[model samples]
Target: MYKILIVEDQEKIRNELGELLRRYGYEVVIIEEFENVLEDIKKAEAHLILLDINLPVYDGYYICKEIRQTLDTPIIIVTSRDSDMDELMSMNLGADDFVTKPYNTQILLARISVLLKRAYAGYQEVVQFNNFKINFSKGILINDGQEVELTKNEMKILACLTKDKGCIVSREDLVSYLWDSEWFVDDNTLTVNINRLRKKFESIGVENVIQTKRGQGYFIE
Candidate 1:
């Protein structure tokens, strides 16, 4: 099931939407802590987000901007502000769709279903490996039927290796993929992350999937 994150402060509306989406077989998570909306979103690994414009600590626009920095997940602004400018601004800020308050639940459901279908309907059509599933849309890794939470660097490294499975990726290429043009990263930091990732793979019985090529670099078979 796809995961949806609801970032509305009103308990009634949030619960209502959550129940509506859950009925359609989507796993919905309503944000309870408004102070750390971005952190909650990252942890939830939501495929889409239902965001409200008017929030307590910070508005939805700020949250949307922050989310777009690292995540390309679809976002729909579900708010009371129903103006052309609001809709345009939301779209400009990376929101895929906008729905006003007191919306027809059926219409909302239809739009959500269409978006989900368009985005992820054919995602799981093929299984890659015995213990790994790739979410091409969200760039997430699933191991042994559970999502493997990876750090930013870990994901980048894994992505690079997965792209060239069985082919060796040099250390220099891995550093370039992770660091900026000017920034420098310590070699020890990369080793530590690789060790942690190996442990994560071991937990799912994919031990030594990432084989070190010693003098060359690393490869996944």
Candidate 2:
């Protein structure tokens, strides 16, 4: 699922946009805090951002430029500012698209779909989970400034467990998933991989990321 972040200050509009995006099968993150908007954006790890120009502290233009300095995440300026300068400035500051308020719902959705496809086509996905940045394509788990690589089986195991956050994934189910991926692993081998995954996280100062529900299975809480 693609994560979309809404960086609008208005509560009503923010909630409305979140609901609109969620209804279309997109993971929506609504940013309410403007004090540290930049840090908040980074932590959200959104594939696309719906940014507003009129903000509390630093306006959207400044934030957009700063983000372009590092990230290539798709940014769509969804603001009430409908001036020629506003649109031009947004494009100049690395916004992928610009939409004025009172936008047609279908048009907005289409813009989001097209931009997400363009930005993430053949792109490696990275997601943030519990203080860890997981890059499934690269098979790497990063914490703070440290990173550890995972083997094929280990990566699959982590992916399975994290697919449903805070929920116990049965060992049988995990084995089946690995088998489907042609990894042919037994229960004992699964245990070994789980232990190895824990050790790798421990090596990066991340402990107990994967929790076991003894009689059931394993989970990340």
lDDT (CA) for every model shown?
0.77, 0.82
lDDT of model 2, residue 211: 94
Clashing pairs in 1: none
Residue-level lDDT tens digits of model 2 in 1-221: 67889999999999999999999999898989899999988767677899999999999999999876545578999998999999999998889899999899999999999987664444247878888988865557899999876544565677777777898998888877655432434457667678878999999999889998989998998
lDDT of model 1 at residue 201? Answer: 78
| Alpha-carbon deviation at 117 in model 1, angstroms | 2.1
Residue 13 in model 2: lDDT: 95
Per-residue lDDT of candidate 1, residues 65-139 (tens digit): 887665556788999999999999998887889999889999998888777775554333334764686555454
- Looking at model 2, the pairs that clash are none
Report the number of backbone clashes for model 2.
0
Model number with the top lDDT: 2
